[model samples]
Target chain A: MPEHESPIVTVDIVLLTLEDEQLKVTLMERTKEPFAGRLALPGGYVHTNTDQNGDDAARRIMTTKLGFAPSHMEQLETISGPTRDPRGWSVSIVYVALISREALASHSAIPLHLYPVAALPELAFDHNKIVRRAVERLRSKGTYSTLPCHLLPARFSIPQMHHVFELVLGVPLNRTSFTRKVSEMGILELAGKEPAAGRGRTAAQYRLKEEVSFFHRPLGDGM
Target chain B: MPEHESPIVTVDIVLLTLEDEQLKVTLMERTKEPFAGRLALPGGYVHTNTDQNGDDAARRIMTTKLGFAPSHMEQLETISGPTRDPRGWSVSIVYVALISREALASHSAIPLHLYPVAALPELAFDHNKIVRRAVERLRSKGTYSTLPCHLLPARFSIPQMHHVFELVLGVPLNRTSFTRKVSEMGILELAGKEPAAGRGRTAAQYRLKEEVSFFHRPLGDGM
Candidate 1:
């Protein structure tokens, strides 16, 4: 391949969380051309000198652009084509990250706009497709993995955790069935605490045993 | 990024199939430096002039090197690092492809070697890691999708298909339960045929419905 034909490699991250009972993704305004001033995922070029790989680049971009590390991160997909970027044949190693709403509220230095996954605005450089793919991956994995825990606070009640899963999965889960299935997975342990007063009946708080766990069976019958 | 620092982009394919009741992958002897005379996955540089994207490059490499198109192909992962390729900073868009064993027998012109997934030889570059990731993805997805069909003939009996799944999953499935679960999925149709003489009991032939099916529930219990 000629020098001019070399593809520009970049990493794009779709950071997702549940805010106001809606599944939202973080977007930043691009300051450079090729779609200047448009909303885009937090990303940048793969620094050959300072970064070791795409994962490193993604983490660096997240910390530098968002000012916080995500609780959960995984490579979603690689979007590459001739027309994805106007500059040249570029490839974007896309990733999906999850952060708790409380964490996002505490770290408010970065000027990021949260948009509902269903009602995302016009994004820059085929980012809409990238975000869609990430959402699908998140929901698909949510069925068998304890990925929803990352979208909640460290200690949360069963109802709060169920709400996060329902929002991300776009379905209402029965409270009894949800609690039973989640408890049966053996990934969550009672924190031996309760919510503050005036929050209706005091629901027992639970915390994820570990970061994530893949269940041998699906959490529910189907989404 | 400067022109000299441009990353060398390529596509490496992990083509898997069942051979002698063992899950095997295809590897070729490298004829160039950076692991010459060693076993490596079939790969080539992404043709900026002829190929549109990594998918196109993967298919092109398959047809040229393996002389057949895979029944199923999907992007596995993109491995990029400064030390992965001894030449320079390079990125390889890896993919996983599956073709029936019968197809491999018919198109046996290429000088390729088959190695079982259990016991693999020293592979060139980080191909061992790439192949491992592909196997993980295959097994993970095999639980809910009709992915094993790609590793069998176009038309096969239920028992033959069950055998393929058992070999790939490394578990013996109960015939009664396996048939019931597969039938409940509604992803297979009778081919109105049976195997020729000399085979075991005459079993009804079946083919995968369309190409593939993603079962809402797992086809069977945990492997």
Candidate 2:
């Protein structure tokens, strides 16, 4: 190996969204060599001069390739297998972002072709595995952590919140029971009445009750 | 650069032990180049011929450096910055191991030194940050996940379990309330009472409830 050659470090963003009762991820068609024209998560080679740190690299990838700063970004994992990238032996730091589906659909600046996770076509490199791992982490940690709130609007009804959990966990919850459990957790606050937007019962909206700092505090027993 | 000189991808193991309620990590005195004699996580450059995958790489490092495999190993985030290693730009897939204090204190196969998270000396590379991040992840994720159970024996009293949580969370829990809450969750079952070992009450021994898989489901108010 030449002493002057430097290993390239890249960043991949797994932006997740919920739409039509299914989880979707934003992907882009690669425009250059080494897996060109394949659907892949938006990413690019990180330069030391520009991306001074891990957080900077993540932000740069989101802004430069996706054309917007992500509201929430987290470092997921790093892929370092020799064949993960073809042009050369490249390492990529993977980060995940959670965006409200409504905001993404209404906003015109976000550059992406969203695809449902269930029907994802062949993705560039090992992105499929990356996406799957991220989803699993989100699903497992989302239960006891404050992550689910990162996926919805500032104010939402209790039923809406239940849907988010159901979708991520891939299970149905009894409405009365779920509400009672959530209420006792003290993670939601009543934010006034909902102006009936549907034909069913007018429901009360809720906001995040409080920031839970305890990580291992167990949930309540079922009623 | 020659084709044979591929960038090295390695896996580093951060073996953690709880010593006197302080989180501690195992470090090795490097015997080779770049930073010889400097303390660092046990690791080596990985190749497919030596082991099957990245996880295997982690095991190899532990076996070669510690002379045994960890009882509980997990995939932590990876460290792949270009400048992390001094000799060349190498990527490291980091993994973590959590073991009980008594287990570590009784072990003799591993020839290594353990240092508290605080009062650490200099490390070989950018491992200080990696170790710190692993600790942060362990502490935070330990709350919402069943990870802490990995640090305990197969059966333990509720008070002992609560004390483990308090030690990791850095906060004291109300004994009466914590026991009731844990029992109410129905995620624990009596394993027949064991005679008291110390000055505490005759604590009833319990193991995690069976078929409690639903407890792992994601929970949150809303996005």
Highest lDDT: give the candidate number: 1
Candidate 1 lDDT by residue in tens digits, A3-100: 44778888999988888888899999889897999999999888887778887788798889988767467777677777778878888888888878
Colliding residue pairs in candidate 1: none
- Model 1 residue runs over 4 Å out of place are A1-4, A195-201, A211-223, B1-4, B107-111, B193-201, B211-223
lDDT of 1 by residue, B109-138 (tens): 776688997899889998887887778778
Each candidate's DockQ score against the native complex?
0.36, 0.19
lDDT of 1: 0.79
Model 2 TM: 0.75
Fraction of native contacts under 8 Å reproduced by each candidate: 0.50, 0.12
Estimate, for each residue in B49-106, the C-alpha lDDT of model 2 and write its tens digit.
4444566667777777777777567767665545676654456777888877676666
lDDT of 1 at B174: 91
Give the winner by TM-score.
1
